[model samples]
Target: MNKKKLIVVENAIKEIAKRDGVTVEFVKMQMKIAMMNGVRSTDSKAKSFWDNISGKGKILTPEELIIHTSELVKQRKSQE
Candidate 1:
């Protein structure tokens, strides 16, 4: 992690340790498990995303996909 994020995580762990009357090591272990679960969830989502997009069933050519993506960006900007 970057320095800023590391500091934030450390601060959070410290708070949790204080509130729960647990050692910093124990809080760190719980944080590690949470981070691992988050990584797994993100990996699963990305795999599903690729599986949906990478097949003969996907009809858009590269150029068409670019155009569609640009249109979606514009729509999002308008909504914002």
Candidate 2:
């Protein structure tokens, strides 16, 4: 990840942790669990979407997911 994006994600996670009275590690674990469940769920659309970004047989780490999502959002905004 680029330095700016990394900083942004770190700051965001820190903010979430502060707001929720939890540690950053706790926030990261929850994110990982949520992503894992979403990818493993029976929803074909969700699976397909993640497969496109993450690859068919690969699971992304929470940091990778956040980076990919940030890139996607940046792409969409540029297109708009």
Candidate 3:
């Protein structure tokens, strides 16, 4: 990850860890598992959606998903 994204992810992980009473490493592992599951999903739409956001043959990181979603929300609000 780039410096900015790394910082954002670190802060987010720390907050999640504190609220959940878990270590930052645990949060990171969960995120990796979730991403891997998404990438390995058999459902066509699920796979396609991931491919769309992550690009073909690429795995999407937590931050990338957040960034994509934030951009989408901003676009929708601008259209309102």
Question: Candidates' TM-scores?
Answer: 0.39, 0.86, 0.76
- The candidate maximizing lDDT is 2
Tens-digit lDDT track for model 1 on 1-80? 24564565567667888999998888766655653444345587744543444442344333333344456679999999
Please report, in order, the local distance difference test score of every candidate based on alpha carbons: 0.56, 0.88, 0.81
lDDT of 3 by residue, 1-80 (tens): 56786687678879999999999888878987988888899999989878888898887667777667677889999999
Candidate of highest TM-score: 2
- Give candidate 3's whole-model lDDT: 0.81
Error of 2 at 78 (Å): 2.2
Candidate 1 has a TM-score of 0.39
| Stronger candidate by TM-score (2 vs 3) | 2
lDDT of 2 by residue, 1-80 (tens): 67787788888899999999999999999998898888897999998888898898788877778899888999999999
RMSD of each candidate?
A: 13.0, 1.4, 2.2
Q: What is the lDDT of residue 14 in candidate 1?
A: 79
lDDT of 2: 0.88
